[model samples]
Target: MNNKLIRQAQEALIVLGYLSGTADGKFDKSTQDAVLRFRRAEGLKRTNIISQPLMPYFEAATLKKLQTNLKTLGYANGVTGKLDKATIAAIKTYQKNNKLRQSGEYSHVLLAKTNRAAREREQARNRRAPVSVQNNIGTSSRSNDVVISSRNIPSQSNSSKASAMPNLNNRTVQENEIMRSEPNTAIQGKMRILKGSNGQVTGCKISTITISSDWCTSGNNKEGSQCNVLYKNGRVLSVRCR
Candidate 1:
């Protein structure tokens, strides 16, 4: 028997919530029951055997379901339907916070534990005082205070007030002019370019700040290239040849 194939099948089953324990590559009774459940769900032959051709089906289904669950639990931002770097990072963070093994991989145990945590948090929130009751209490307290009329209040002369207030419009225009005149000096020197798994230039890092691909416009930039980085809003915006 191919232990590797069995392990993969077990992991897929665990991710789909059919199994509850770790995938130990052993065809135990629990694994067999999980496989039987999965077969019934997919309308396949009611057998516990995981064939070589069934690997792709299991992988695709498991990844999509895992991504959906991770996103719903707030562990991931968006579901790209693929196991990308962001998804792995979210998984690792979730596992670390939950005191799990921190494997940064998907499993039924992780999902089940996270679901329970979410339910506990929701119950705790529901036990708190409602916002409407707090607002009513504040309103009741303020009702006993005296009301003041704007017409009875003293007012300053328009001429005096106009002279004291500075020309805010002109000041704003001057500040904008100064900002436009200033040179872009967020990144003074060259920084190292970074790439993704597809060998495309994604972003760069200077010192300690790591810029992401969304903030970078990599025009003819390559990985490991020392390029002049344009910075904006506390991030690297673009990379160009000096």
Candidate 2:
């Protein structure tokens, strides 16, 4: 299958909670395993191969699509894309109401129904919404030109505070400015990107690879270098490195 198809499958699987990784258009083992799990859950013959007939199902149920459709169908609270506890609860409630199995799995049928229902709801909403004619070009009516819907606008009180939200770009710029502004120190440091089993960045390093839990210097590279693993969390676990 093409990378596009693989990416789509990965996206669908992710929303369905079968996979965890960015869909970077690669047919990796994680994507294959996700496909297998989905197939098994759906009572289809489980296989690593991305069969032709399964493409549509895989392309369905993307996180954004799921949130949009679920919200439109009144099954979800909002379109946050992330399937947190609230989202899972909403999915369960939807499944119960629809008389479908309450496995909380995002099936092809669920996705298809969601898309259709969301479309219908959008059409109905549009029909009910007020429309306005544009004022003449270069006219002074620009300030008054705006569209308002009759629908209730949800409050953002529950959302994160602006101050609490990280300004990533600003932080990066500030760091760069600081680095450039500061004099070079004698000490220097190097860092390596860490990957999960599926090769996605996990923001941590492999601590140990030996059969025993003891720390050893065996897995050093030819340059006589061993990784001094660091972690965001304090706990350490033994893991195999490829």
Residues 1-242, candidate 1: write the lDDT tens digits.
Answer: 58898888887887677888788899889988988898898788899888897777686676666565554344554556677898788788777766678788875556556556555644633442211111111111233321111121122234444423233333211000001111344443345555555333344554333444322322333334455655432223344643
Task: Please give, for residues 153-224, the per-residue lDDT of candidate 2 as tens digits.
Answer: 222233536533233333211000001101122111222333334322223212121111121111221112
Computed on alpha carbons, the lDDT of every model, listed in order, comes to 0.52, 0.46
Report the Cα RMSD per candidate. 18.2, 21.9
Residue 7 error for model 1, in Å? 2.9
lDDT of 2: 0.46
| Regions of candidate 1 where Cα sits further than 4 Å from its true position | 43-45, 75-80, 84-242
Clashes of each: 0, 0
Candidate 1, TM-score vs. the true structure? 0.39
Alpha-carbon runs more than 4 Å astray in model 2: 1-61, 129-242
| CA lDDT for candidate 1 | 0.52
